[model samples]
Target: MNLRLSGRIRVSVFGVAILIAAACGGDRKTFAPPPEIFSEVDADAGTCADRCSLDGRSVIRCSGEIEPCPIELACGGGSCRQPCDAVATEGSTNGCEFYFQPPLLTTHNDWPYSCYATYLVNTSTVPVDVGIEFEGKALDLSKAIYRTLPGEAKLAPHVGAVMPGDGVILFVSDRESPIDNPRYVACPKGVVPAVLRDYYPDGTQLGSSFHLKTSAPVSAAAVYPFGGAASAIPSATLLLPVASWSKENILVNAWEAWRTYSPGVQIVASEDDTDVTIYPKADVHDGVGVVGTPAGVPATYRLQKGQFLQLVQPQELTGSAIISTKPTSTFAAHTCANVPANVSTCDILGAQIPAFERWGSEYVGVGYRPRTGDEHEPMPYRILAARDGTRLDYDPEVPRGAPLTLNAGEVAAFGAGVGEPFVVRSQDAEHPIYLAAYMTGSNGDYWGSGRSWQTKGDPEFVNVVPAEQYLTNASFYADPTYAETSLVIIRAKTDGEFKDVSLECLGGPVTAFRPIGTRGAYEYARVDLSVGSEPGVTSDGKTCYYGAHHLRSDGLFAATIWGWGRWTSYAYASGMSLRSLVSTPLLPK
Candidate 1:
């Protein structure tokens, strides 16, 4: 319900689906209660005891007569406080149940008590049967998410446990060399986080993507540590599941000239699949003509549910396309690298790029939130031609000095140095190209490489989310150890385009705003994610600031988070970033 611009507006409730938007108001309020006043008479503490804390944001169940409250009190009966109606978050979903296990992973935790992977499994109605498969080994588990709390938030509690207690029986393989025989273990019923130290006893550095097949509906996420012993540069990605898979995709590749970490592609099959084809960038003539059928790719490839295939850079295969017979999830990466054309050691880079079909016709390039005048910084952006004969035109263009024509599979990159955020559009809808941006790394004072003692100054990558797919609301998780955290937001510039820009954490609404930039229709903001700040870990050890946001906009908008890693007095740290999981699924093609 948008708060009426003015006051006096008639409200009515017809059918359940019918909703009345607020309009202009006049002098008097229609339903507002009288001003609140203190009473000399004693009140009953027993009746209202624990209502606010025990029930949380649940609706207020009055114990007695309604007491008058002032307008200042959002929702209150006398002095007893109540939660006002929070904006309900209900993003579009296809009602499909399949989801992919995340494509990229970092170290699960530190050491000793730490594990190999940390995954959050959110189950749906009919409990899901899950199976985990690794190099020829398998483990089965089952679990369900019980409905609880506010219905709009889709809150569910984690139930069940990982069987076999410790890593003894299920992972019975001798913890020595890798047993390449892959298999998937089906579960009966249960849910809990598991450690793969039994499978990878060498301890987590950078590792493979585990294939998790679910029997019922579910949403999943997996995160890993990217930095070495001295620092923490952890990263994560949300699985889009099989129902959300795409058939075609092409984009900027993540390769390191210094070779700190290699660039590669990871693919997971969504069904009992058939033929899968891969196309390398260099194998195409002028990015279009075929030169011997995807040189480095396998001529015959296939995967079943819960099976994954990883293609490494024995060859430079960036800008390549993956075509599969069945729906499949894909992830791209540079393992880990550094920033600014400057910086010392390498940071991590990984993102789940949506298929070319999900690509938007228009986009604007912006840099990671800078400590000073961020608008003046110039960052490089890559544009991949989705089809033949695509042309890119920029509004109030800057000094690119590059060609604009592109053929199928072609890639073109240009710098947006201190220019207005670019406004680009393609000549035809069929000629749409995928968009992405990269941070050059740190400044000259700190940039170094190759050796373990230097800052990993590798490039960082994040998808320039399709402007048309942007939602007024977006959900994200910020790392506690990240040195800097910022948000990149883009919305329609015209009036009445957006409304009630608010933030939500844990399970309630919060008013946390830190403006980083206002680039025309876009608004950038910084978030405090320090271990001891708001949205930080609570006394219960669970993170309080990680959850979905409630956005009540009048029209459409786009937003994403940018996180960097650095130490207080250290000169050797570099930063990396990727877009957070988008809850809204793309329109079906």
Candidate 2:
């Protein structure tokens, strides 16, 4: 025990910034310690006295004689200075255990929550499984991120038990479906304001950081009721050479095998620039192409097989073949609308296209959909306009900002969201955003023509169009309720300038709503529409769209667990097989 403290208590712990207390003549007068001079001692009170309530609860425990405490009478030594109360443990109240509160969520009062964490500043690493969703919900469930080795501290199978400030719902990927996880990143609700901040694995800002924010303007909505479910403790921020499409630079590549094989991928020119200039070879291949450039120079095509590709680089990227051997784009709308019309069995269905323009209008026009359902009930239908004649509908009373038309044979399915209604037209009354399209059969199921069987299992066809004899105009209205529906748009900066922007959608079934006019998601760090303009529009106006099918089936009615069949019944009832769950049984490739 090295307990030495005498030369007048070593001048009172170095004069403690002068709280002297009456010494006149020599000039010295400071003293602050009379708030009832209290002191109590006892000990231990963990799990926070079972969630704190114990009425006037007490427990201090310091021991022996050290008294003196003029420094505000030792904060009175109660729970050692309030380790968030209930009763503290040691140091910073045993390093604070958990109580957050702002906006994260997964299950809440029901449990099974998720927003995990295990190392904010190096708890050794592994335990990173994040998912925290926010903009319009429907992330479902996701897991897999625990990868560390360097120093090796471990213990974060996605952490858990957090409360500090609240606000979360992460869930980025559980094997496809928060609209097929295009690098997912909604994060909105409360924008991270609970407290206890200290990040760095690429999200930046560390030590004493926490949630904070008070200038307001965070809500994208959803803290509780709307669908209900809460969980938070999860957090994420990693992009790197971007998990690989080689690493982003085609400026855009809706999908031509990563802009003909990563001619260096990246996008977002301004609003804080990621550098934007892409054009090594695929200026516009599947969406419309120019191709040949071994020196040749037509350099100006139009691509359109369902739409995909948006590169942005200074051009000039020849190819000996790290990728573009060509031979891929049969593009029957992303593979004959993903077969399934009874094509034997396994089942498939794909089609995408969402490009809308008019905020300042600069020639934007693109709309397509076909993510049906059937191979054992896959479920998404989004089609919107399959045409058969001259019909069009969109009015919903017609007052709130006008402009609506398109009803012919109907074909509008925006992922079936029950009751339906919203044809289109917004400026935010509170939260409008609507646009529909539907069609999927090959047994994928969505049923149209001769309905009934509970309206053919109703995956939410919006009313299946047909409202007993067309003509209801007033602005047209039908959608009543189905809950989760998305296809929002508005990311202007030039052609109309909305202001520092970034508003995207694809949590599911709302594909291709463009406006990349650029405005920060980290400047478009690793964009991949497939390369520049999925439906094409951005010269400086921004807008790219694509949302197709995501049914995510898992029986027993399971709602989460990656949505479509609880990860294919957790790899077929646990026998596991996506090729032996990613395979490695001795490594063969």
Candidate 3:
């Protein structure tokens, strides 16, 4: 094998500007090596010299000294790599041969931020020494391996001297330079095995665990949720509350009731004398049956004493939780009503409960059971949302602030795709909140690729993510409710997929709503600054160590995440590495 492979690899400029003055080719100064650093040259003419290895009589040189080499090398400058030619078949016997041009990173004058992709033979003989540290925080270091290749980089050979293993690593300095500061830094030390961890403020750690060497080239199609410019999300109103009931309570109540009335249950009320028909249990063949309100009954039918209607639910329904609820109207859409039995909160109810199902214009109550006979019963409660008549839509390619829904699975909402919107009827009002998505991947662990089909099949299931994978303690605003809420659905064919990614307000003056079950989908995750009290609190709070799941299409697996919380600051740090995660660009250029 001619270890010296010939090829050109394209480098990615992740929206960061290094030198403001020069484009790609223009240059000025003759680069000089830093003081005390000397280039080791090949002393023996037509022979191996100074740490150079040899295969037979051929001197294998991935990186060594060459007096006649042309280009000037500048170390510690964070500048683009200037290529040099290989005069001989220089093969390195070292574990994984590596050599930087001239300036290796040092503390003195290095740029605060620099991005470099490590290849098997260019800069490291052993695993790369990746480190992350804040000005006052402790320094962390670790060994890294590559997962995917960007541009034209090849895979590293399992047992060879010149493997093509390469992937990008971003370095950031805690220095307060307006131009050169890299926002995030990763350490070499591996903790929580398999997950990538970013640290800040001395002891703060961000994100879950990431496996070693799984970082790869992100495709142009990968979508990132934090794609918008940092902006303020003015105050907004609440659309609906996602509430959860104890699984045991819901199932216990349902099961107990089912056992008591084996086939039929009686309906009696302290106020109403007329008996409402009830279905005792769920049918093995057609599911559960719901009783209808007899003639002359008021539209708002309260649950009678010991008169419960049969509802077919999830097998895991240890109890039932209200995933979401929208506002309801009496006749002319003005008689707004609050949630049934929950509480009589909120001042004005425009349209709190949104149409739960968006079946291509066909709508239904918030809690309509899909495969049951009682599916026709009007939903028990309605969400008390404002009717600013403001609606927004979601588009995978559109920028944030564009209307969207909070109805996607954990991966789509929290990862790349934009999602359904949470509409606000009121023009502008503060609605402090936190959103989170929880999912179970094929591997109980998010970074393990060899574990199951779910991990290998989908591009969306990225293991190593930049910080903020688990969004907590953040503020947000509802996209306008007047426009049509654009819902961009990103369904993956991979196993261990995600269904609903929910958000809850843990801090703030107003009461918060909790999510019960999976009901909506988000194409991409979003945060708002104007609606919450801690305008400064954002997704930058924590960093996750694992890669996001990849997208796939051949099995029965789904991952869903549950989120909730509120804190001025988090224990995690930001600006870690996304080398292990996947990417989807909103624009082509």
- Cα lDDT of candidate 2 equals 0.18
Candidate 1 ranges beyond 4 A from true positions:
1-192, 198-221, 226-233, 283-298, 338-343, 372-374, 399-403, 417-420, 443-459, 493-496, 505-552, 567-589
lDDT of 3 by residue, 494-559 (tens): 123333332222132111212211332212322222222123223334311111112111211112
- Candidate 2, residues 347-396: lDDT per residue as tens digits? 11111111111010011111111122222222333322211121222222
Worst ten in a row by lDDT for model 1? 569-578
Order by lDDT, highest first: 1, 2, 3
Best of the two (2, 3) by lDDT: 2
Task: Report the Cα RMSD per candidate.
Answer: 17.6, 31.8, 30.6
Candidate with more favorable, higher TM-score: 2 or 3: 2
Best by TM-score: 1
Candidates 1 and 2 compared: the better one by lDDT is 1
Which segments of candidate 2 are over 4 A away from where they belong?
Answer: 1-277, 280-561, 564-589
Give the Å shift of residue 385 in candidate 2. 30
Q: Scored by CA lDDT, what does every candidate get?
A: 0.39, 0.18, 0.18
